[model samples]
Target chain A: MGARQTLGAVTDSDSSKAKRATARGRLLPANQEFAVFATVAVCFVAMALTMPSFLTLGNMFALTRGISVLGILALGMGIVVIARGIDLSQVAVLASTCGITVVLLNNGIPAPVALGAGLFIAIGIGCLNGLLIAFVEIPALFATLATGLLTLGATRALVLPQLIVYLGPENAWLQQFGGNLSIGLPIPVIVFAVVALVMHVFLVHTVLGRSIYAQGDNPETAWLTGMPVRPMIVTEYALSSAIGYIGGLVMVASTSLMHLQIADSSLIFDVILVVVLGGISLTGGRGGVSSVIAGTLLIGILLNGMTLLNLDTQTQNIIRGAVLLAAIVVDSLLHPHDEETSKQGL
Target chain B: MGINLSKRLPAIAAGAALSILAGSAMTLAANITRDTSRQAFDTAISGKKVAWVPLWMGVLESEWTGIMKDQFGQYGISLVTRDPNFNNDAQLQAVSQLIDEKPDVLIVQNNSTTLLAKELKRASDAGIYVVQMNMASNYVGDAYVGVDYTQAGHQVADELIKQCGGGKTSGEVALILGEATAAPSIEGLKAITDGLKKDPTVKIVSSQPGDWDANKANQIATTVLQQYPKLCAIHGFWGPMAAGAAQAVKNAGRQGDVKVFAISDGQMGDCDLVEQGLFTKALSNRADVQGITLVNAVLSLLQGKDKPGDKHLFYFTNNYWIESAKDRGYCYKVDKAK
Candidate 1:
């Protein structure tokens, strides 16, 4: 009887050990990004195999260039969301500043000075958003929404009453940013790549970056642990605004103008969609530049393909909204939050 | 007896003088009546009130407002304008309120065909004369003064066919619409589709909506260009929006190869773009002329001769094709003060 009991105990211990090993593997395996990246790859391969025109150099370049601006904005939004915040005003900030830049340039201001003024305004608005959310105890969602309306309204009233500013002929140098590089790649795509690399390094290697994650994970705990959680929140939003300005520049470069009407369009929602669709959980504290790139790529490919297929806007929007809903559902299932993990302010 | 004779002689002299004066006065009155109809003119035109509700006060609508205000003011009529700023609900509210105020004329530019249909019917039933501009609604108002977009579309497509139709080019064409459901856009698309059917060689490779956005046009046009490098011509619904597609073609270094056509509100910006060779050919409906037409329609309706909704009058203004620098006059200049 003792021998039999010993054998049974050994078997039980072995089974428990195997179970623990598998659980650890599940915890640390290729993350949500891997799944998204895989999906992108599969779509790309399928598109290339089926659509004869999809593999062409011109089409490939166009696809990348089209997505470059969206990718950049998604990256910025991802950073803010990683720190458990949202930015509904990113597009408004971008449109207003870009309009100001063009209006200044058209008035004979030098391109460099005009560009600086635009970036400065964008960052200022972003910091203002941060101040409202962090210092005034306002929710990011409501604060950013109000800030966006205020920014657009003020810009429209004070500067671009016409709401559309076209780049002048003298601004060829400014327009080059939207053009091609010597290597036959779009400059915007190159800009997007460089921005992504820098962001990846900043998030993965820096102390402040880790703090953003911790703060997003549990802001109260992070504050108790001596992190300057408030300042970190400000920095996150400021960065988002600054990067959104870059995306605006790309947009202006590509189109040779800026239409402030975009402030009221679905662009901000699209940015958020791409960010979250790539597995950037809105509940906060997860996702990086890779997730943004994956999201951008998937969206880019889908849009490019749909355009090729000549689908109408309504059909396209329906598919896009469905995909976003599915992504949100999947995110909730994968990153289940208990009562303790929910942010205090939320 | 001597007194009576003297009195009679004085009376006869006075009678002759009175006859001469009365004859001259009658002749003068007859001439004046033959030359002028002052009372009728005053009753028809002077001291009227007109209320205009536009979709928004953009360059085009503002131009219309400036023209209307100036002309109506000159006619001794009071004009009130409410700018809805592209919000349909606000437009509906403005129309309803203006109807209640009971202005002699209520002119509206509908954002959609049905959004203001009920309100317009209410205005007409309330004995208010209604004028619809640029876009018409299902409830036809008293008078409609705008471009016949279907004809404009045919003009644009015909121009495209001239450049890209029978063996002149690769025959691959694309169309960019402003909005899918907008009456102007839908009628224009249908007309272009029908017009393109005339030339079997020309094949429409892609037809998409830009949603009246320049950037969206640029993006879609860029992708279409990539898919069809040998694309012969591209047509867009509006000039300002089509300018983006032109920019795309220019960016692709295919500006000279691709002929771009559009029916645009002939704003100065459209002229500038055409002069810069961004657009190949533009069928411009002179907004300035259309604005004048709107004022004239108001004048005709307010002659106090017709009941509300009694006259279904339409003033289909002509469209001009802007092809070269010399055709710049076809596009109207927007006043800065407006």
Candidate 2:
């Protein structure tokens, strides 16, 4: 009887999949990755037309360098969002971990050890977020939000206590991560690109990756099929936090200071905006690596263009909001509501 | 889950209690040593508690705190700080909580001119001497110390007039403010613009709030540059954010063309940027001096024979323009090894 029910569901899914395939063919027929490719292309053209300096090597490099940290964080957020969860504490965890690392480094601890310990603490925070959301059954949003606050507060109390930790001249290796590598490419840009590629492979080609989709698609179904749903959730959050820590390291490297203030900025919201704009349905089970890249590129292009145009922050915010809203509208039209989609929180 | 919850609750409660106790102890100690003389303050405030509540302890605020922590520690004043982290409600609540704990002197860095005015008034009214730092409030409490922002702004404007307001360069200038509503930034920008009336050649091409964000400043600088290529100078209200404008200029291949100037709380980061020629000029309100001044103001209020309403003391620190490598006195580089 269980087998028959499973088979029936599979058949239903198969038919829906067929319909989706047909729809995708009609709408995005030429390129399988048309959504991401088209968005990047459009952003490039728009920026180049609006700002003459937008296409210059110097400006382009700066834009890429600026977005590297954002891209890294968004990559983590994308993974968590794809797994039918969200980690708002990523930035806060990053800040706390990075702040601690700086303090440790300042105290004469080796760079590698400090970096490792920081990453570990970040992962631990992610696990805490996971434990709360998965075991306690708290909503991912509230759990991560609460954790973010806790981590930031705790770090401020225990570490520098309202101080900015400036990495000295001795921490040259760490600085190099943010500084330039080759002729014009920043180390952070390279790191981001590499991380993106790794995440792409992990999300697309691995069994764990498939499980993430399964968990996102239908938690109940995934559990029924013998998948460890709670553990999967933990893994996803852990991965997000780990990536977020690296992003924090990149931020500190680029800026030469570990500022606890970064966590308080509207950065997490921007991460979520990038993820959603990339067509990662808040309903989950739909978006993947391509979505994050697409979203990051769109935001990067918009920001780069705005910078090149020398638009004020307020106007840039307006343009960004409008673009995000437009993206949401497009996403909604493309992916209509379904019962399975209801399981993932929008 | 139940066990974890029980464990976490106690840990959180303990942390809260410890912080409160530490906060109270610092205030009580500072109050206890109120009778100490000016010559004795360097020793009297030693080991005493001085709790600080800032709107948010950013790079600028932290530098002031760092100087205080070091100087006060050497003198025997224990500094306990509560960072509201830019939340107005949180700041108010922290102040109320800190006041209840009765710190010797509650030093507050107000977000707006008015957000903390009522609470600050209440603190002084409750016999807790309040030291308002850098930013002022309508309350005009026991002691007000820090930069004369209006004066600083006027100075910057006067300097700009010398540079661009004359017939020397295209007088097209831009103003990058920290926050639109922030009293200091707003007043400073106003003063500069008002001061510009002395010369008709200066045209304020773009004046926008960057929210004290470097990235935002970069974007603003870029746009303003594109709009007015002959822009002579961009005056930023904060140092780090001004660095963004400088970066934007560099990125635009107009580093030498457009000049970037800003006012900062003498942080090494700001000074370093200036020394690197990322900024044309930086008006640094020496944070270490301000920190010492804040300690002195609090000590005076605590020990002074004057009652609460008698005479509200105000100390204005001098601002120095860091124009070249030779003018880096405003900043103190913190060497952790020391």
Candidate 3:
């Protein structure tokens, strides 16, 4: 009996030790979490101090609404970047697809049908990008870049050639998407929030989501483990394009105009900046939804504060660039490279 | 599916046939006309394609293009257009490619005077008729069809001089420029400076470029208010942007103390802003008249009545000041119902 009790105690000790190790591995370090939290806190305090109206609810709502489209786009971009791939064509896909939808609706197509067709078109572009990158073995960057130009050119050629399709008065259903929910809160904010929640769940709860991380971490290992790596890559880009389409829709709604120029704007760079700044490693397989939110909030706060402070556009641009650089430096410092994960195409 | 297929088949067939017919008609039209302007327009353009590029096809450019397209399109005139969506390089490249296409007429809206000067000269020497629209270029083309910006600038400066120039009202004045290097902005600024020379007591306290952005104008006005407590008047180069500047003044609790002035393309937004007392005054350029004039010019050119360099044809549209809320007609507004 004595021997059995001693053995039981030893077994219990081993199990508890194993459980503690697993917990430690699964959760982020407290110090690291604290540092991130502190960065956000510091940004908020700085903005509040500089701009008298920065802390107001109206301004906060406006800032969130303004960043919603970019944030949504970055969520998908973050996913693609996490999978060891980049999509330069995301904005182009959004513009072309969204532009098509607006033109179709203007020509009397039903709203639902136009939206479905637009989203499909975006996915098709994404699939094309995937085929070139995965099957043809073109570099992701070049493939997306080429695809972006093609999409933009095709849009110009096929759609309303050089016209601003005004949908503000024609489409009430579409306009409602851009309208405020409760005075200050816009529908775009809600859309982004819902999307962020779903993406968080998807990344945490699903088998495919895990595979994305695995693929990003080590593509060969993922393939060796019987994962459908090529198809998965296609799906990843498809998701990005689909999300980009939604972002475009929100953009048209917010701006009250279907501008073909959005794709060519500095918007894509801003999206990527948000992703990278939020602690999502461009090397892939590291960051998730939380990182995106943090990055977006930081940027949104900075821009809102600048707006409130009445900073000139040039000065605002300079400050934004500087902040992005600082964020990158901080991220690099925090996540020192590990040889196994840092190499390209892993 | 069968019903949809049948419906689409006829539509597709009609589209194809219509396109083919249109193509043949254009070809036939191209073959029938001869260049009447080549000898006279030779100095302006003789050996090159004139690419008329605008920010985009809007009511303003459509009128301009209607004239050019009708006249130029019939005369075997090879006109190319690049819709830049207000982008700078796209405009530059369109001009460059037109140079490559070698047309004889290159009419353009200077996105800014300096951005396309080198290319404009290249087109000129390469032998292209370079007619600049409402804006001037650093490199003067053979002809410029636009307003005398300096005159407009002086007009506004004189008005401000009467109201606030002489330490009589507050001695503080603000200037809002469009894009920094825009030809109109530079010309307007120079004219205002020249006019200010006549009024020694007018102290211009703040001058900044709003980039022709309405939101930016508002923000700039906000900051200027913070900097100058006794700003008596504000002058802006564009209508919509000026309205935004006015809004900022109003928001800062200085609407009566600060007066806003601007120049506009008679867009309804400017008129509406004016009516709302967002602006103290706005100089209006009738974009509708401009458009109609452009169409008329194109028709005249196409009818084989005039050559390119025979004489410089200028259309100087009237500019009016909307000094009161009741003066809405002075500015142009696009009817949403239309």
Candidate 4:
């Protein structure tokens, strides 16, 4: 979720092309993002009318901070989805690896070393998922699903036999990752914003990022143009894991505990939901940072408003399910299934 | 379930003054042959196979298992165990298979009240005495060894009222409960509400389900704290999830100001949180001590001649309030080496 993509980023060479596309494609993901933003605004207005607490500054900060983890995760998921892939193992990898980091820290290891080890393992798992899908020719669905279980099982057997890993008191400063800045913004929200900015620049301004789009659009065509498609897919998954780790760290800082049970819970589904709800298509090669931000905001608003109203879990789930269904319907109408998308069968 | 939270809990209860006596049996002396009662106890318990199926082996379950294993080993009872990990379907399958094995007694830590109700009934029907631990199901086993959660809930509510009500601070309290259908969240909530009825000043502004996840609890806590900056206290149904709520209070710069409480299954980490001042207090269901109670339940079930379904018994483990370092004993240590 980056700052809404602006025309200012368009150079002379791409400006005409961008403007022409922007004009015809109110049907584009950006337009979809606009629709999402409008929906969020509408939700905010409605909630503000009914729930006097909703528009308060404290609640506003809370809403933004609370969505940071989901927003960060959705950004990573956005990258992978843009590359015509999915990583069901994202939560598993993040929880295990980050939990391992806390495990190390609790065991008296230095912070950097613990974090480094966790990062290394996270990237390794991501690479494994990439290799399986790209080289072994396994579908992303089965590959990531299998790897998710494997990661969880291996983690349980090796380090985290229990479901949670509590951060040690000696390393209490690590909590700063989730603490607020002087300006009242949470560190996690800032991190989410920074990550989104970097992702947006990478996606729009980098050769590797451009190649990812081409590869996602059509692997055969991209391969014909010598785009190093396989390696790019590997990079996308690896990057996704790296970003997911950051989100996990923020989560740990906020909660002071990482319960690996999240991997078993419906959390990964929530991550994927945020990603897809933000305009990232399962059919792939669509949506961007702005899309993710829009989706996260809408969800964040919905969740915050519900909690302020003290809605029960079942009611929240029903509302979430309804919103998700509506988004899917809106998405399909905007990006009609073609030969390729139909083949993908999202 | 450190579900990888932390490796804690040493042999906290093994050598404690845990009197393992059930029915006519008494604690055996060192010289067993000199005592006919010891011999009789040995005869009744020895060679008996007790099978256990937990939701998953979390710190609480492990603590109970360790005590059971050591005691059962000494008594010559063969304890068969299955770990379904966390899958409800797998738990059902394992219970079915264990029932077929026809162990003398079957112990299950039900994930939900209904998931294993029928299986428990079938096990009882199969002549296998059933022992339900921590949480009970619809089908009453031969014996149950855990908290009378409604009573526990009343205690929690009373504690919350004492800490936050009577216009002490902001009487607004938030509850981050476990899974909605779980006994702790459902019955515990109702009882807490029932208890809170005594305090007209106390207001429960938000009661959200954390689904027993710390992160979910943290998010909900953050929002609730924001909505009521003067929120006097936050109560969580479980410790790990409450840690998240505690952190949110800390993040919001309201640690001592916003009291945080959890009804914890006395894990070392739960105690550690109290020691660190993250939690104002915790109502610890002494899991380590519960292990002794669990062993007693199983032994009684074995020695009794009544039919499984006919001899319905409930052993409510006493709960302790963990407020300081001295109360840390209430929390069990994990068998990290194991």
Candidate 5:
């Protein structure tokens, strides 16, 4: 497995350790999520004090809406990351599957059936990825990357050879999902919330979710303990792909068109950034749903503020990179690696 | 007639035949110029190699390639096209390899202003007629044929001013750019910035790079709208990308109130947007006619005796303002069968 070198992953989250971490102070929390939330709060306060428009209801909706699709994708990425794996194909899968769904819709397929077919294709790709990573024993990163490319090429050849697929007016129902609610909540933000809540429940309250953590904590012991790790691997990837499809649909709804070139964009990196920024370890087994939400909000706030300031992309990217690096450094300082984990080196 | 009938008949017959021969000879002389021109064109264009490297075979590039094949193939010109698929390095490699083949003409559509600048210059230095189509590089090659992006941008800004500037509405316009480094974005913004100088009331509230991704444009527009609720208009650099901004405005329920403008290569989708009122205006760059312009540029270069890279021969493409259904011809229909 191409397990990347990351910081000493906290494989245990026992209450004793949590109480001790709490005793340490308000400066450090039991996990990465609290620190991220605090960061968002402080930044929000700082920004609001300076800019009158920063705290408006409409701006809040705009900020959340901007990151909702990314947050949705990160939810899936979070699941895969939790299982000690990475899926580079999330963006690619979404781009192609969503484009195909629109094509079907244009060809007189009912919205449910067409959308379901797209979901089916996405799950199929996820299975292929899991098969390669689990049964074939390839690295998850390479497996998903290849499958993503294959899916994009196949979709282009079979359905959307053109780079863009515009939504027809007959499918106006789908566009409604992109609209904002009367209460000023963009539908995408609500979609992210529902998906996040479901994902949080799945991770916190289910046997399969616990098994994913166990599997990521120690794969060999998990298998020896009768966890059926291989099947779980397939399930997580399918979940990832399926969630990615939903995000893609939202993208279609929001944009009124899907540009296949998005697969070629840097969107996947941003999704992973949202996941990892909130402390989802690449080595896995440590983070949870709060981590994903925190990450989304942090990135969303930063991006929203930058947009409001009218900063250039380069400056925004620089600030983003520096903040991520600084956060990681601060995290490492706060939670120094133990000798055993350092020697094991993931 | 009584003296020598047969002899006189011979003379008269010869005279009539002489006059008819003279008449036919004049007709032949009149046809010679047209025949020679065609012959000259065939001689100049036939057996010549034209290598076209599009930024990638997207819709516009494909349309150009299709037209070139149908026209160039007729004149016995062999066209070798390499689609870099929007990758700059691959494009550079393709142009370099084509230059090595010493084609009589090289037509390239650049994705960047400088990716192929060196290669284009080298090709010209090697005596290959380099014609940059639609998008050109920083190093001016021989005979550039593409949009007068500045003029197009000025016209668009002037239109925006009429609709939104000079106390027309909010005087707030946002520009959703693709790549700031791209020629279209750079020139368009420059011209728009300059155009706004004439009307100080027309303030550009926010300009951001959407990177030509519709989703990005959507997100940016959503945020900008929140920041400037009364944003009068938005100008998206390209049609497909701007479609996102239009949708964002529509999502904000400002479809007719907040105008959206886009510059498109007349992809029917853009025209469809205008027809549906999603887009307030579209500056249509007719790629179909642009293909003809490109062909003529190649033909002119091939027939001329001037050395490659000696001087610039440029053709600024025509821009048609598409606002209503009557201007549908400004848009070119794509073969979905492709």
Candidate 6:
């Protein structure tokens, strides 16, 4: 709900309006996605031409690998944003869940068991968040925020002896997710691709997925049409948390340690940035995996280039903020808010 | 039976006589008297209130708090701590409330150079002694207990020059800073910049902020390594975050090529990393020592000799280079407060 207003205001697409436009024989609504994709391409070529190290195989691998974790998280956030819900708790849940998993592994729990229990806890937190938002009628923004704090605090108090939990030497297999796979492609990139493919299939082909979109489009219409609106909302959040668990796993695997301090970093806002930058409309039910991919590429390239240029974090943050502002402006110019489509729920 | 009883009675009587003599002698040897100076010491410190407002309770802050708590308890002083959890607004509120509570001494770790300047002034005006730790504010307090980042940074840079400068290796060095605008980082960077002036051949090829995140450090370090495989040394501001940079170099098979040097909070983890060869050397300002310094400052203030905000005392702590296994004691093991 916090990021929703900020992101939702910049969201250009209204699925219902787009449907009406299509019904009226207009094929093209706007080219926000195209504009973003083109910008990414332009930046890519510019960086490659200017920076000698940009196009190397190693640099390319580094860029994609870095984006994998963020992309996975953005994908999860994209689903919730499509449902007109926000998840401020994703990073917190990810850190705590994966943190507890490593702690268990250190205490002799098998890899599979620890991983399962970790993801189970993550999904459970998501369900609690869903219950609060869907059935208890609390706003998603506040609900996730409170839950995030509760989970992080609880995990810190009960399990983590400190802010960081390092992976023990016994878990070499678990570390493979962060390493290179066959043909030298980083395992995180592979995992991201697999997740994107699976998520794409789920959203396009599943009945529950379609219902999530319908509910986001209009909760009143969705309920009136006898779609299990409450259950769908719960499932949407569960999916977001579950996917976030994968990102957490990759994070721990790659870094060999999970520092809970990351939950307090600006990583979540970056995830939201990728979601919106990819052309996923926070207005709900307007973007998918492709949009997330496009957004990730742009950001991944920008960050990688900035790193190559050795710009300080302050300068990089300035550029990042400017880019987000520019994207919002473009989105607003292309799709001005109309009174009929401006009914707010989140 | 009668003969045995008579013999045993004589022996028992002798033992009783010896016990009486020993008791009297012991009391005579252990004569008790209270010294006026000791009484004055107790009177100066006992029942005094010391309020601590740290930026947050990380490993470093926790160790510092642990030591302060133990020392204060021994001195019969009361200590209260408020953890702002790194939120600036919350810290400001905590300081405001602490001022109203009117503790005899207030110690704080400023999140920035200016956020708590006004409130600190208010506390000083209220006749409270203030001590700042690690990072200082625009408003200097009664005492400052922390490292001189410029000196520490110069030492680190000089160490780097010895390792990679004057055509020893490829003169390329990389810097992984904690935060761009943090006072410690700013001062440290300035010192490093000035120190590098002594060695013209050494080139700083890359500089970026890790924002105190290990993952960010890992990613950036990985990219930098990919770009400059011949990078001679990587200097980082903090230890835990620099562990990621070390790991990145290790993963690239450049661990032997790249020298990793950093300054740490001197927690056990930094020493463990050093022993494991993750860090070539670490210049640590032991948090435990800093905590003890803070206690000493508070105790001095509570002595009621120094005027509040008038006596600007500083306890610039000594730094330790934890390089080999022998430097283990330099890094404190924060298992239990001593």
Chain B vs. true chain B: TM-score per candidate: 0.88, 0.84, 0.73, 0.90, 0.88, 0.89
**Candidate 3, Cα interface RMSD:** 6.6
Q: Where is model 1 chain B poorest over a 10-residue stretch in terms of lDDT?
A: B1-10
Q: Across residues A270-336, which tens digit of lDDT does each residue of candidate 4 receive?
A: 7788878777778776778998999999989998888888998889889998998998887765554
Looking at candidate 2 chain B, the ten consecutive residues that score lowest on lDDT are: B1-10
Clashes of 1: 0
Lowest summed lDDT over 10 consecutive residues: which window, candidate 3 chain B? B37-46
Off by over 4 Å in 6: A1-31, A182-184, B1-34, B336-338
Clashes of each: 0, 13, 19, 20, 0, 1
Candidate 6 chain A TM is: 0.90
Chain A TM-scores, candidates in order: 0.90, 0.89, 0.88, 0.90, 0.90, 0.90
State the lDDT at A182 in candidate 2: 53
| Error of model 5, residue B22, in angstroms | 30
State the lDDT of candidate 2 residue by residue for A123-223, as single tens digits: 88889989988899999999999999999988977786655666655675676676665576667789989999999899889999888887776788888
Compose the digit string of candidate 1's lDDT tens values, residues B105-137. Answer: 999998899999998999899999999998999
Give the per-residue lDDT of model 5 (tens digit) for B1-338.
13223323443454345434543454465553544555655665699999999987677887788778976887799999998878888988999999999999999988888788888889988999989998878888888888998999889888988998668587999999988788888888999999888888898889999888999899899999989988889999999999999989988888998899999898878888998899999998888778777877777677666799877988887898889887777777655432
Reference A-B contact fraction recovered by candidate 5: 0.85
Return the interface RMSD of model 6: 1.4
| Candidate 1: regions farther than 4 A off | A1-30, A344-346, B1-47
The local distance difference test score of model 5 is 0.84
Q: How accurate is candidate 1 locally (lDDT)?
A: 0.81
lDDT of 6 by residue, B1-338 (tens): 24323423543454335434433443355441233444655766799998999988787888788878877898899999999988999999999999999999999998889999999999999989989998999999999999999999889889888899998788899999988888988899889989988998888899898888888888898899889978998988898788878877766667768999889888776777788777999998977667766776676677645678888888898788998987777776554423
- The candidate that wins on TM-score is 4
lDDT of each: 0.81, 0.75, 0.70, 0.83, 0.84, 0.83
The C-alpha TM-scores of every prediction are 0.88, 0.75, 0.69, 0.91, 0.90, 0.89
Candidate 5 CAPRI grade: medium
**Interface RMSD, all models, one decimal each?**
1.4, 4.6, 6.6, 1.0, 0.9, 1.4
